[model samples]
Target: MSEEPPYVVSPTADSSSTARPATFIFLHGYGDDAEGLPLGLAQQFQFNNKMQYLKWVLPNAPHNHEAMARAWYVPKALPNAVKPRVPGHEGEEDAPDDEVGIMQSVDMLDQLVEQEIKNGTPSERIVVGGFSQGCAVSLVWGLTGRLKHQVAGVLCLSGYMPLQTRIQQLRNERGIKDDDKDPKRWFYVHGTMDMLVPTRLFVQGKDELAKWVDKENIEEHLYQGMGHSTNSAELRDMLAFFEKVIPE
Candidate 1:
C-alpha cells in the first residue's frame, strides 16, 4: 500500500468571503490525480466575478503500478466475462469487478466528508463527485444510507455504478424499500458512445439509484457520440446543477 495522495486547492477560492464557502470535492479518474481536475476547472471558470465563494478539493489516488499510474482499486475479471478495459487504454477487454477496492475508497471519502462537517461546513453545502472510477466510488457513497445525509449532492461524469448487489442488500438490511422516494440530488451524465463502462451500465445505475431517490430529483444527461470522457456542454450543465443544489 502507498501513502495518502496529495490534494489540490483551487486559486479561485475566495479567502475574503466571511460566509462559510460551499465545498466541492472531486475524485479523479483512474491513472490521474488531484491537480488535473481543479486545474482544468480553473482554466474554464477562472473564478468569475458572478460566482459565489467556493472551495474545491481534489484528491489523488495512491500510486499503483511501476509506471506510476494510480487506480482506485484493482479490477478483477469475472468468470467467463470479457476483461474490463484498462485505464488510459482503449480497445481492451473488460476489467474485473472489485468491491473491496470501491469500499476502501468509500471509507477514505467518509473521513474526508466528515472532516468537512466538523470544520463548520453544513452537510447540505457539500457536493461529492468523480469521473469514471471516481464516479463509481461516489455512487457507492450516495447509496450508503449512513452517508446519505453527509452530502448535498453527487456528480457523476462519464462513470458507472459498481457493487449493485451489495447496495441492494444493504438497503434491504436497513429496511429501505424500493419505492421510498428520497431526495434525488444526484446528477449523473454519461456519453452514449462510452464502450468502457457502457451506456447500459449507466442506465442500470440510474435505475438502481431511482429506487432510493425520487426520479424527479435526479438529473440525467447524455452526450451523443461522446466517448468515455466529459465535454464542455456537460461541464456547463454541471455548473448549473451545482448553483441550484448548493446555491450561493
Candidate 2:
C-alpha cells in the first residue's frame, strides 16, 4: 500500500453541504487494489442517483506482493483434500491472519464512520460492503462487532460464509444478544460458478450459520453463469439493495 494511498470519497450531497444521511464503505478483494470496483460502483451510484443522500468511501487494502502483483493477503495453498481442481494464483508473503487483520480494518472503518458522524452523518446510516475476500471480512465484522453503532446495511459479493466455529467465538466475545435472530441487515451474494470459493461452500456455510441464527435474517442472491467477478446484473441488484436499505 502506498504510504498515503488515496481513500476516495464521492459524496452525493450538494456542493456546499458536508452532511449525508448514509455512507457506503467499500472493500476490494484479494489481488485487487482498492480503486477499481469500489470507484466504479460509486460512479454508478452517483449517476443513477441511488441513495442520493449517501456518500461512498473506497478504502485501499494494505498491499502485499503475491503472484508478482499486489494482494490483500498472502495466498494459502489449499491442502490436497480441500484444494480446488484448478488452483488459484499464489502471491508473496505469508498467509494472512484474516481474523486479526479484518478486525483491524473494521476498526479503521469505524473510525472513518465516526469522523462522518462528527461531520453530521448518523451512525445508523452507515453501510459496509466488499468484494470476494473483502465481502467475507465485512460479513464477519457486521455480525460480530459492537452494535451500539448500528449500521444501516451490509453487502457481501461473491463471498462465502466464514467457518462456523469462528463465528461462534465472535458472537460470544462480542456479547451480541439475540444470537438466534438472523441478521436482517445483511445482503449475501455469490457467483454460481465461482471457482475461487465454490458456491457449494456457501450452501454448506449457510447451513452452519443457521445453527447460530435464524435463517430468515440473511438474504441471498446466487447469480448464475457468473464466475469470480461481479457482472452488470449483480451491480444493478447491489444498487437496488443499497437503495432499499438506505433511504434517500
Candidate 3:
C-alpha cells in the first residue's frame, strides 16, 4: 500500500519565505481527510507577523471498515443492542487495546516528528495534537514517550486515552509519581456533553495523568454544550495555549 501523504498549512504568503522555527501537527478524526482542518485551523489561529514562524501538518488516517473512510486503529466490534444515551458517544467504553494498529500509527507519527526535526524544527519546539482517535494516539505518544522525543506540548480535544490499564501498570512498576509539578504543559479541551468519549474519561485522565505529570502542568477546559466536535471558543483557547506553550 502507498503511504498516505499529509496536508500542510502554512502562514500567509506575505508573511515570510523563511523556514518555520516550530511545527504543530494535528491528526484528523476517523473518517476525515487532512485538507480541510489544517487550513481551517490555520485561518482561525491567531495570525500575526510572529505567527508566521508556525507550521501546521495534518495527516490522513488509513482506510478502515467504513465506506471510503479512514481510521487510525481498527476498533473492536460493539454489539448493536447497546446504544449511547446521547448521540456520537458510542465506543467510549472499549479498552484501548488495538496494539497493532495503534503501534503502526505511532511509528508513522514518530517518523514524521523525526522528519520535522531533521528539516529544521527541534524536538522541543514541536507539538503533537489530535481529535478523537487522533487524540488517543497523540496521548500515547506524549505519555508513553513512544516518539522518543520530548515534545513541547500535547493538545488533546474531545478524546480519551487508550491503554489505560497498561499505563497504570507501568506507573506502578516504575514508581512514577503523578503530581502537580511537571514542567511540560499539556492542554486538554473537551465538551461536557460529548457522548463519544464521555466526560468521565477527561476527569479520570486528568487525575491519572497528574500522577505522572505535574498537576499544574495539565490544563483542561470543559465546554458546556459542545459535542464530538470543535468550536470557535476552543479555537480561541487553543491559540492562547499555543502562544503560551510554543516558543517564538
Candidate 4:
C-alpha cells in the first residue's frame, strides 16, 4: 500500500546508534520488498558477523497498479498476458522514457541517505546498492542526488540504468560537474546470459557509467553462464567490494 520504515540492522541488531561506522542501503528487485534482499543474501553468504559494524538499511518500493507489484517506477512497456516482464529486453528498453516516477523515487531514497547522516554517519561512509530495478534507482540517485559527491560508493548487481539518453541533460539541469576527479567507487556485476538486462543494455550501462565515473574507480565483472540472478561467486565479490569501500 504505502512505503513504510526501512528494515534496519544496526551493528548486531542490538547495538547502539553510536556504534555505526558505515551504512549500506540496498534496494531489492521489482516485486521484492525490504525483507527479500537480506533473506536472499543470508541464503547465499554469512557476512553479517564480518560486517557487523556496518548499519544496513533496506527499503521497499511502494505498491502501484501499473507495476502490478512493488517497483521503483512503472515501466513504459507494461507486460502482456501470462506473466509480467521483469524489465529486461522486450520493448522496455526502446520505449519512450517514463521518468516522472524515477525522479520521485530518487528523491525519496536521497532522503533516506540524509536521515542516516542526521543520525551521525557521514555520507562518505554510506554505500547505496541494489538488485535489478533497485540497482537502477541507486545509480540514478548517486549521480543526481544533491549530496552525490559526499556518498562513498554504489553497488549495481545485474541491473541497467534507465534514462540513458537523458542522464547528461538531467545532470546539467542539476548543475552536476562534468568532471570530478575524485568520484566515488562503484561495483557493477552482471551475468553474461542475463536476458532481463541483456548484454546490449549491460554494455550500454557501463558506457553510460564511464561518462560520469572514472574508469579506474569502477569494478566490473561478467559471470559466465549465469542468468538474471546471482550465485556464490557473486556473493564473494560483494563481500570483497564491501571490504574495499567500507573497511573497518
Ranking by lDDT: 4, 1, 3, 2
> lDDT of each model, Cα atoms only?
0.72, 0.65, 0.70, 0.77
Q: Is candidate 1 or candidate 2 better by TM-score?
A: 1
Please, what are the lDDT tens digits per residue for candidate 1 over residues 1-248?
A: 23664464543546676655677778888777776764576456654543356667677777765224687876543223233554453332354457667777887777777777887778788888889888988888887645556578999887777787788776676576666644539899999877667788788889988776778779999999888777778878988998888777
Looking at model 4, residue 150 earns an lDDT score of 76
lDDT of 2 at 20: 45
Better of 1 and 3 by TM-score: 1
Writing each residue's lDDT as its tens digit, candidate 2 over 166-248 gives 77677777776653443336777788778777787667656664564456656678899998888888888877787666766
Q: How close is every model to the real structure, measured as TM-score?
A: 0.82, 0.79, 0.80, 0.87
Candidate 4, residues 46-93, lDDT tens digits: the string is 354666667778888888666678888876542231224544534663
Instruction: Please name the candidate that would achieve the greatest TM-score relative to the true structure.
Output: 4
TM-score of 1: 0.82
lDDT over C-alpha atoms for residue 62 of model 4: 87
Candidate 4 total steric clashes: 1
Candidate 1 residue-wise lDDT at 173:
65
Number of backbone collisions per candidate, in order? 8, 3, 11, 1
